[model samples]
Target: MEDGFNIGDIVLSKMGRDSGRHYIVVSTDENYVFICDGDYHKVAKPKKKKMKHVEATGSRSEYVAGKIAEEAKTTNTELRRAIAEFEGTENVPVQQDEM
Candidate 1:
């Protein structure tokens, strides 16, 4: 967590293509913060010193909770698939290579 922003805090970007864009704080270093917007592909590491350009818009506790729930669902599904494979009832799911 940074001195000014906590992880999972929602914020609005004030500059760049992400200007006025809403994002959730994911991490912070001494001077920069990592954020994830609705678009996971749009994650950023912006400088805290320049954070004046950003505004704390809201809290992402609920959003985080939703993400946790989604992850749990995926994990459960994977476990079930694995069990099915072990029981010889289904083929194992393929693991795709990362691009």
Candidate 2:
């Protein structure tokens, strides 16, 4: 199986408070990737997590990939919508700040 992660790729968190959550890879380096779920981690502020901490789901979002490729502005709404579409859900509500 192709286990590599790329921009716009959906992943499942294997660790942390967000464990078992799905997120999109927004950025990456050799050892880490920045991920956002639109709910917990907004696209504007992705969370940098270790690559080993996430498991690649082998699914990708073309919309998110295009946005990342073009460096276009992304909002939480868009992220939520994309994720919801990928998950076959009606809609994904924005997460409230827990502070």
Tens-digit lDDT track for model 2 on 50-94? 999999887898888898899998777767777777778845465
Worst 10 residues of 2 by lDDT: 90-99
Best model per TM-score: 2
Which lDDT values do the candidates have, in the order given?
0.50, 0.82
Best candidate according to lDDT: 2
Pairs with steric clashes in candidate 1: none
What are the root-mean-square deviations of the candidates from the true structure over C-alphas? 12.3, 3.2
List where candidate 1 sits over 4 angstroms from the true fold: 40-50, 62-99
Candidate 2: C-alpha RMSD after superposition: 3.2
Q: For each candidate, what TM-score against the reference? A: 0.49, 0.85
Q: By TM-score, how accurate is candidate 2?
A: 0.85
Query: What TM-score does candidate 1 reach?
Result: 0.49
Angstrom error of the Cα, residue 32, model 1: value is 1.2
